[model samples]
Target: MQVSGTFLAFAVLSLLTIGGAVFMISFTRVVHMVISLGVTFLSIAGLFVLLEAEFVAISQILVYSGAISILMLFGIMLTKHDAKDEGVSKANKGWLSILVVAVFFVIAFWGIQSTPWVAPPDNAAAVQEDNATQLGVEIFTRFVIPFELTSVLLLVALVGAIILAKKEEDNE
Candidate 1:
């Protein structure tokens, strides 16, 4: 099979994304985990761009990479996390973990095999250029309330974090 530039890029990004997720789970530090999560989000965003979903790509970058990542980092900084507390986590349910992973693997494999994928049109010139514009307009008109609610949700989370981070007065 002839290898294409898009296929090569997709393969590299897929490896980076999987590696990031694995490293994120393996990291002991909360900050390292958040950064690794950002890597996975970034690679997914690149995948969206590759699929020609520009609006989704930009939204992924803004929401996942820009906002969610910063929020996580801020939350980590606010919490009293000690390096000595890192080893507190241990794998307690070995069989359950394996069972859950096996179930998900079977479901994903079945889904992939069952799905019918259509090949793209050979005439690339037939594609329209106003997809992003149409998506933006629809979002503003139809999904404006949900979009605003998401902002409100983020604000509420920030406030909750601040409340959690507040310390009691110390008696000397």
Candidate 2:
């Protein structure tokens, strides 16, 4: 019973997340788009919780919903004076795009449903567990170099944003 309830919850959240994403993309108003994005992030976090990844769920909420969404909202605010007037145009071929996407989804779903998934043998399972642990350890240690590089990239992006937002001395 509990498992079924969780599955239902996950399904509902997934639908909400997709709906929110669609709303975000379709809305003309920047504020409405931001709010829809927040809904999408929160729904995804709920999904992570349902998947038993508590740490990842919290991080998703903190990083995406809290920090990234706020950053995007701030960017929108700084870049545009009138929110409703900006990005008001919808795609001219939206119906065609939707039809193509639906056909692709149906084909992909049929292909996936036809697949046979097999569990690993005992020896393969042992190797898989060891490999997973080793991969995690390596990511935490040797891969720190790439991680630090990515942080530096983010810092550079922040600096660029500040430069762009700065008013000229004459304007000030």
- Highest-lDDT candidate: 1
TM-score of each: 0.74, 0.70
Candidate 2, residue 132: CA error in Å?
Answer: 15
**Candidate 2 regions with alpha-carbon error over 4 angstroms:** 1-3, 85-92, 119-138, 170-172
Which one is best on TM-score?
A: 1
Q: Count the backbone clashes (under 3 Å) in each candidate.
A: 0, 0
> Residue 56: error of model 2 in Å?
1.9
Q: Each model's RMSD to truth, in Å?
A: 3.9, 4.6
Tens-place lDDT per residue, model 1, 1-172, is 8999999999999998999999987898778888999999999999988888888989999999999999877767766554322543457676678788999999999999999988878786345356688777888999999999999998998899778777867837
Candidate 2 lDDT over residue span 16-133, tens digit each: 9999999988898888899899999999999987765566788899999999899888888877845773442467676778789899999999999999978757675454344445
Whole-model lDDT per candidate:
0.85, 0.83
